[model samples]
Target: MKPELLPLLTCPSCRDGDLTLEAQEEDALGVKTGRLACPTCRTVFPIADYVPSFLPEESGGERWREAWSYKWENVAEQVRYSPEGDEDFERKLNFGNHFSGDFRGKWVLDAGCGSGQDAARMASRGATVVGVDQSRGVYLAQRYNQDTPHADRLHFVRADLFHLPFRPEIFDAIYSNGVLHHTPDTRRAFDAIAPLLKRGGLIGVWVYDRTQYWRLFETFWRPVLSRLPRPALSAFLHAVNRPWHWIYRYRTLMMDKVNPWPESSVARHLADLFSGGQLLYLLTDYHLHLAHRVEDPFIRHHHAFDAYSPTFAWGHDESELFEWFKAQKISVTAISPVRTGLIGVKD
Candidate 1:
């Protein structure tokens, strides 16, 4: 780790100045080249290759090992389907006034870094980022980030949210976009990562916006869809949604008549080309959709045990969220109502 960066660090556990960095050797997994010890807490954390391991235990253990396996299984496809086009960028811009200034040398933690897409974005902006994900998402992240200009600064690990293996108070900023909600206990997940932040560190989170549109789908429709086998449901979606794709691909008058876009001819033509109704449906099954270990018989279940476990899928109202944050006593610096983006700073 850079010597200049050391002064900005503090003990993640004690949140005091009693911690000191010890020169330690890198382990087999290239973790914790040094140690950060908190005399107050008697807690020692390892820093691997300059990236601290805040996890309480190993990344791939009992509770979250399956998540890593799932990430490894589907990361390539997930990255491809993630928002990558002009529309996606627009969506991210809509999220809050995050990163209005340069982040050229900031140390950032991308919590729940699914497939490392957001991590890649932060790195592109010149941030030295460490992306942590429970799933084997780190594998794909490492693969995608290896050749970049900031590769030396970018790192990843398969880790749990509850027991992060990182030194406390080391990160300048931490962000988790659309991730905390997916955990078994969202509040616990939030509590786990929040303690690791430095006093002045920024914490930005983009959770699933509680909307009627999402509710209609996630609550009523998704449960119904989750009942079927994966292959059968996927095939059914592909078949039924074929017409939408056909109309989209062909731009025929009849097809447009059935699935209307807008009154204007040009608008109709454009919608047919770009509208993502069918593709969205297919993605619902494979990506956003979840099964209670029905798809994979092996490994432990994370979300659903009875095939209908509620888990942490609960959505919060804006007022409820604000009150929760108030209870935490964190200062809200910026709020973006458009994307339901909430950005805060720890005092």
Candidate 2:
């Protein structure tokens, strides 16, 4: 870690300014590696392979841990952009472009970066990227960038959202997509990083939406579904989720048959796929061991945490978020093609 960056960091746990670097251990390769501890909190966050781990302890359980187990690269690579396919990376990237405002020549921070995919895209677009996550997923991010031609412009680190190690004004811009909502305190997590931005520097974050319907789903299902044990609950969900898939197909097939339009193909397909995917994702990944180890090593037990972790499942609507961001003096640039995705810029 840079010595200058250390002075600017406060303990994310106790909000204390006092911290000390206690030890450095090197392997046979003689690489110096260790963690810095907060003198007040006595929390030991890991610093491995030069990346500092700033995330809070796992008291909130495995939601963040499980979600982050998917290597950043794997998550990024999963996005296959197809101009012709019903669903493609290009379409999502097109929607994602709203968040990439004026990123050229900037030092960008990919907060809550599950697998350095977004960071790689930024680097490809000419931004110096820093990918940070609390999980062991950074290893994949490091390896992903290493193989890239622009590896010099990309760096991966293990850092907490509330306890980032960078100095204030270190980044030219920061954006976190599909993160923050997973943390225990979403507002505090946002507050922790707000000060780190340069004056007038860009900031955008895409969190889960909390619309009226979404609220009902959370109130009724997320809480109840998250209560059951992984094995038993997963089995039960797999059996029950079949109906949702049937409904999705039935709706799409009925819609296409009644009013078939070329333009409607994408929307209908997306609706159908999302419906099926959500249930499967919830059942296999969160409730059972179906998605285990298919993508990354650390992710074998990913969804098991989500089954019972409420902290990782919170969300909010765009109107409420717009008001909050406006109060902070941040401007809303776009809400993305998906209502769940939001983009903002700092004044």
Candidate 3:
């Protein structure tokens, strides 16, 4: 962590002020190794590889932390050696489009930054982004972005969303995409980060929407899948992806007939058979909406793992989320055309 970031960090445990840094190694670049000490609370947070660790010993959400940490560690080499080029950049642009103000020269907080991809993108756009994640993905993110032009502007910290190690109203903007829902309580996660944005500062978030079809699937299958051992679950997902890919590859032939739900019993039985009768309802429902857009086998499997691996993956209702923002005294700025992305300004 850099010496400049010391002022922005507060004791997440005690919410105390005047955090003192004990720099074990310092140079022209920054504090290479150090510990942030909170005198009032007597808490010490270690700085490892220029990233501060603020996660508590008994941090809740252990399932997600373990799953993402393992996932990123395995993919770190792939991400660093051969980064996703245009496809990645396009996704970042789509994410940034939800925000209200320009990011240039802004102090942005990327809450739940996975592998630091979006953080690096925002930093490349001239935002000084502080990316925080509770998992070991922070290390992967740091390594992945180490060679970028905006590497100095991007900071990684291992911190939990419920207890971030930053003072209130310190950030000019906050962007959290496809993250909050994975936490045990999405609303609480939002509430925790909402206070960090400066008054009038914008915040953008994209979360899974609780569509009726998605709700039905999640209600029935998510509970069982979430509890499965990692190896078994991964194996199951790999097997599931085979059929998913097959369906996508031949979607042209089968999609039109099944795209519109069958009105007759015979067609319904045929649709069920075509879906392999394994997760019949869920697979058919998902393929109907997304099979045409399925590209990149790696990303398809990655997203499949991401969807079912997390212990808590709650989808939100648009109106309910907007009401929550209103209750927090934040003015709604824009809701994305898809209705999953929401942007609001702190009042």
What is the C-alpha local distance difference test score of each model? Answer: 0.56, 0.58, 0.74
TM-score rank order: 3, 2, 1
Task: Give candidate 1's TM-score.
Answer: 0.63
Q: Which stretches in model 2 have alpha-carbon errors above 4 Å?
A: 1-32, 35-45, 56-105, 212-219, 228-311
The C-alpha TM-scores of every prediction are: 0.63, 0.65, 0.85
Q: Pick the candidate with the highest lDDT.
A: 3
Kindly list the per-residue Cα lDDT of model 1 for residues 1-347, writing each as its tens digit: 43444554555455566456776774333434787677877888665554554555443344344534443453234334243322333353325446544777788888877566677777877888778876655666666666667666677754567656566777888887667776766667777787677888888766656772435435655565555554454444445443433443354445557766664476664464356442333223322222211232121121222112223455555565565456665677766554455678877
Per-model C-alpha RMSD: 8.3, 7.2, 4.1
**Residue-by-residue lDDT tens digits, candidate 3, 1-347:** 77767778899999978789888987644676889999998999998877889888886567778887866665333434324433433343254565434678789999998788778877877889999998898988877777778887888999999989999999999878778888889999999999999998988777777883455665677788778876776677667676666664565456556567653456664675466533542432243344336455555555556666678878877887898788778898777654466788899
Rank ordering of all candidates by lDDT, starting from the highest: 3, 2, 1
- Once superposed on the true structure, which residue ranges of model 3 sit more than 4 Å away at CA? 26-29, 75-101, 255-291
Using alpha carbons, what is the TM-score of model 3? Answer: 0.85
For candidate 2, write residues 42-150 as lDDT tens digits.
8776656655677655556455465346323333234322122212123332465654455666787878765566778778878878888877777666655665776
* lDDT (Cα, 0-100) at 54 in candidate 1: 50
